[model samples]
Target: MKHQHCRKAGNVLMIVGLVVMVSSIIFSVLNQLPSIQMPALLAQGAILGIFIGALLWLAGARVSGRERIEDRYFWHRHYDERCRRTPHH
Candidate 1:
């Protein structure tokens, strides 16, 4: 799949997960009854959203045509050089 598609799917999954989690919270609150399952459901939704979102975002970043300076070891070397050149108090 294309990077754009992956990114879009990730966004959708994240949004759906957030909605599910929020709804679960509201359901539990409005019911005024503490249920063990509610906590489990909320945790699942949040974890799923964050995990999938991170995966997709990473995929998009990896496949994108642009080069990332952060991804290069040379960048780190240059970073140290630049830091050395800067005045420190």
Candidate 2:
């Protein structure tokens, strides 16, 4: 079957990576308690994963979705507007 959303497999992979990263952040933060040391190395790894996800998200946002370039452009306009409203570094 063909994907109606992302055009490439790489884009899907990026989305999955992004999900894992976000979930990791949520897990780490929610697990943060007096007893949970959450070793510095692991915390750093989570941060790195989050960073990787953000980058992949950016890439997928830049290059994925839709069949025609026009459709991509339309979605991109929406994405750009959303990004503008969001706080970003």
Candidate 3:
């Protein structure tokens, strides 16, 4: 039960991270007033937001195990008895 809860939380965290990253990029691009100090600050903040979002995504992936890579060629599950035996021509 706890693992399920953790997984849900982790997934939510990942979504939040994505939102942060996207918003940062959008705002940074939209703020074209290079002469203003606030725009400069926003540009800097965009960088920080990207970094923070990446960290959050990593943490969430670790907790959720949803990002883990898998080898498609291998499966350890037991096969049917007929599959275990040699095929007869």
Assess candidate 3 and give its TM-score to the true structure.
Answer: 0.65
- Lowest summed lDDT across 10 adjacent residues in model 2 is found at 59-68
Query: Can you write out model 3's per-residue Cα lDDT over 1-89, one digit (the tens) per residue?
Result: 48898899889889989988888877776666565445567789997998888888878887787665422112212334433445434
Cα displacement (Å) at residue 17, model 3? 0.4
Q: Kindly indicate the candidate among 1 and 2 with the higher TM-score.
A: 2
How accurate locally, in lDDT, is each candidate?
A: 0.56, 0.68, 0.73
Better of 1 and 3 by lDDT: 3
Report the C-alpha lDDT of model 2 over 7-44, residue by residue, as the tens digit: 57647767777897887797568557767766778877
Candidate 3 residue pairs that clash? none
Top-scoring candidate (TM-score): 3
lDDT (Cα) of model 2: 0.68
What are the per-residue Cα lDDT tens digits for candidate 1 across 49-85? 5555555455445455323735565655555566455
| Highest-lDDT candidate | 3
